[model samples]
Target: QLTGISLSGDQKQKPADLEKELDKLQTEFDEIENQIRAGSPRYAALTGAQPLTLAETQQKVLDDGTVLLEYSLGNDTSYAFAVTQSGVSLFKLPPRSNIDKLATDFRAQLIPPKLQRRIVGIDVVAEQQRGLGLVEGPSENLTAFVASSNALYRAAVEPASNSFGDKRLLVVADGALNYIPFEALVRSTDGADYASLSYLIKSNEIVYAPSASVVAAIRQSGNKPSGKNLLAVADPIFSSDDSRVKGKAGVPAPAEARGLGLGLESAVNDVAGEPTAAGGLRLARLVGTRVEAEEIGKIAKSNGSQADLWIDLNASEDNLRSRDVTNYRIIHVATHGLLDAERPQFTGVVLSLVGNKDNDGFLRTDEIFNLRLGAPLVMLSACETGLGKEKRGEGVIGLTRAFMYAGAPTVGVSLWSVADKSTADLMADFYRRLLGPASSNSASVAMRAAQLGLISGKKYSAPFYWAPFVIVGDWR
Candidate 1:
């Protein structure tokens, strides 16, 4: 079976060779499936619901003033399918290699290089200096990023511009393109400063989906009404030396550890252990998240909704699993997110490590699949929560998919390591817009508004701060 194919590429093959091999394997699998169907009439029943065809998807999933841009990265030449209610238009895109390089360069500019550290065997400095370049005015990083963004727009979106009038976009990106935030792409470089540049977000609301079939399924299973409004978990205490910990242990504090109440843009630290090791990992404290969560809870309450806030010791894996978290309309977790590319199952959101025998701090992807989340939205306000191992046709097999399977209609995730205070500020504005009076009450709309607000502000006007967060799945 194709499942046996090592996605890790232990023996790397050229793109052309890989495509040929996949095609050959798929043909054999199809013949075997045909034989099975001929042998037993019950084969169809065993296969569950088949994927929706283009016509079915157009009728059932898409609406007027909405366009679905789906891309398939190929060996020789990539293709983009612009699916609207009117018709499906095909556009030629750059080859996989070209798109991959552009996407990598674009992401690098948005997320600065990580600082090398020997103690935790992790990169720390980059997180501390995330949005420094854009703040200092038209640095090399900003210029390079704008160039890359515009190039990507030409390669990915501009070709299909005619098919996409003034409409909401449902993007299905493949391979490396999955990491590129579509909303951040510049329409055309007008020599405007970073803050005033014409971003795609300014014109259209965008939402991402793994596939058309997934979109149909999510829309079919509409959001269930929840008793509580918001359940926010944040500010997990990682070190025993933390002042919040009553009995201070003698373990050394994390390197370059700063004061707890430092401002938002202060250096945020990550706790790392040997890739194979578990337990005794010391994550730097996220003091800004405490304020972030509290402010969100207050907003929910003022908007006439019940809000539950969990912080410090209370924000543990035990509490996450034990509590009736499914009862809330929105579940916001603000903490560290660890991405395990080699082992996607290990990709998890870090909560308070202080727990009982079975509880470790990590809420790994496999564990998230077991969660019963009925919330309309689940926001993982942490570093690289949107990233995961890429499976050929399965989109990103990471935290987003796990939550979707667990019953969240929509999810908000970060593409890169986000600034602490800027993220908090963005989330506060997002929640206010989401729950406020005269609100559209749509996740996609609120996200766009929040990002626009950040761009207009002086503090976090850079794409690094506002562009990382994207809404996936049901826009409403």
Candidate 2:
């Protein structure tokens, strides 16, 4: 009941009443959990939500050449459990504070400070003009990123290096470590250029899960193959002033005024100024996503598969739900992604806001749970789609988990705010390999191949361009 309330974005209850009810329910739940713990030592272990035991995880979740690295951060010290089919090894790590700082520094290197700055209440037009070249270019602080990456590797992976030996990794991160993309971690700097660094991805294929139990659950659920190849949703109409909107009577929002705000209006204001007198938050149109969706559709069709595309005004919340999305083998959403750390329920993917009486543009996390997706892979090709509120044991509660619950065996999400062109390019390469003829590569393998391609390319060789995207849930 508490979870239902928390996840329901369209609840009619008043805020005060809801808060009180949630408080009461949480207290009752805690008391009941305590009683169950007291009654039997094994009762907690038997609960649906509890993590699977090491033996159970090894038997059910792991394959012959796969290993799980589950980290638990503590105040004084942190620990990692390297779980393999044959045995489990534990490694100690630095305190949570140390890891936190390193993760923050690393993210700073990837996301430009201009992009991170809050745009709310500011003159969006002026800000956009001043920051005309706000793209995430090569960082002058490359050494800083390298140092942080190496340090994180030393703290997190070095202690357990011997145990990992040529095995694919299933990372279950905790707290700040959840934000760190393990693939970006440098194994050795070794007189390497930005493009030629010895990243972890170069050697091992990696996937992520909120918990080992999640891995077991998703794998157990399996995927119901859909007859259709793809359902691509992109290029939402965020503002009525958009030139594409026929017969609308206002000046088109400037390209500079247009920015990706996900759906959190307070977090990022894409419009030129404050909300209109009628109180509507204007979001920037994602022109790149249109190209992205079209390219992917072409790829699917070229592979002799049927692809359904919802773009421009057709990309509405109503269309998304009405289309029976579960019939597609792969579901791709290329749009703005909002993350509300304080309120995970608010985190969502933004679609077309126009002509949708049933919903606002945002498709909240809880709302995603309601979707009946049967696709083996669901790719959220947007900024920061991988992030969510971190729970010590359960992992990051965000879009990845929502998609898993909705029936996707595998999900692709990004760790940081990414530039449009780079994201489109990376995603195009990914789908081409995944759906190509005679392709036996799993989702993780395909993602790795795409990232490697970017690393080898002269245009987007920086880790920032490719490392943010990761595969979660079942890799196979």
Candidate 3:
């Protein structure tokens, strides 16, 4: 920490004493030429209009007759030396955040702990750090979480700032990462909870972490998560009423955000006011077509050798293995679909009434890493099953992508909300045709048959059917 030099107490030194010392150093500047480096040494130019180096050399003229030029040495950094009768100098420094933690001649030491899976993603409003504006974390993990959290804290560092207490999100795994509990740390740090440390990720309906984000939400919702406060944090995002993405913040809503109608009682009224031509959920609904559960079940059962169509809605999380999924030739989830704005990659359609983490909640595009579909076709006969965004312009993003990502040959997903009764009716007709002995070849042919059944009735012709559903990826 030291290079053998230290400062005298400035409180005792005062302005008068410091002035006397400066006078002494300045008066004697001429006497130290033999020792002083008089050459015009070059300095590395700084970029972005920032300083390359701090004041390395400072020579001040003082009132006293004698002059002083001093040089001081320090550790791990370079600085200029001032030569005078008194052999003393000051050190220069820049912003602390920019200093690298460590350096290496080899690449082996460059890794940090792998990002904890507990944190799936985060949503940050705005943050300020080191005078930088609007900081954001691009991924979920300790580094990004800490960085985003640090930005919030930094916003409150200076005078009259409230950004520190703004709502911040951290997605943590329920069982992964053996580090300190993030929710507790936030509580100790003057932060409000997101209702609970827990939340329902649409991927699998698996509540990963009852994080602060979810906890604060529950309090706002006026609903308690039963027993323990920490064990079961409340979720605000689950409320269909308050959890809406208004484009006012310039943050794009995920494609599935449309489908997470779990909390959207008010959205029913709001969505009706939006331009139908703009698409949105209206277009999604236009594409949606519903079918009867019994009919689809019958078709799947016939395909699976007619084994009671045993779709266990009450399956335990531990027992929700991929093997259980293998028996059925078709998987039909009558739950919810979520497409997040910030993390469309984590976009998924959640299975209802399941409790398994990872597999239990939020079925993402990648978790099916080893899943191979034996089912020639799959139907996510759920809400907003086909919601997604086009890379360019305003169009539709298909829920079929997740099935495709999971290796399904062909998937039939609805684009928007569907009437349960109508969906049931449409499904019955669709399956009657799909399961007909003549229905064979590719999934497209079968879907056409289902479409025929869907529009056959005027009651099912809404966007909720025809416009809301789309077949995607390879269909063998």
TM-score of each: 0.80, 0.83, 0.36
Per-residue lDDT for 151-224 in model 1, tens only? 88888889998888679999989988898798888888775567888789988899998777776776666655
Best candidate, lDDT: 2
* CA shift of 421, model 2, Å: 0.8
Please tell me which model should have the higher lDDT, number 2 or number 3: 2
lDDT (Cα, 0-100) at 14 in candidate 2: 56
lDDT (Cα atoms) of all candidates against the true structure? 0.72, 0.73, 0.31
Per-residue lDDT of 126-236 in model 2, one digit per residue for the tens? 121112234447576778778888888888888998998778999988878888789988888663567888889988999998877876666665564455479899988
Candidate 1 ranges beyond 4 A from true positions: 1-49, 115-140, 225-228, 247-281
- Provide the global lDDT of candidate 3 against the true structure: 0.31
Error of 2 at 296 (Å): 0.7
lDDT of 2 at 445: 94
Best by TM-score: 2
Q: Residue by residue across 1-476, what tens digits does model 3's lDDT show? A: 10111122232334356445534543553244213323311100100112112221112211122112111112434232222233333434222222111111000111112211111111111211100111321122323333333332232111111211222212221111111111212111222222221111101110111222222222233321121000000111221122232323533233233332221211222223221121122112111121244455555456443422322222222232354454344455544444432223335544322223333334543333235444335666554445443322112223453343333444666533434455556555555555556555344445544444444444443222333344432232
For all candidates, what are the clash counts?
1, 0, 86
Pitting candidate 2 against candidate 3, the one with the higher TM-score is 2
Better of 1 and 2 by lDDT: 2
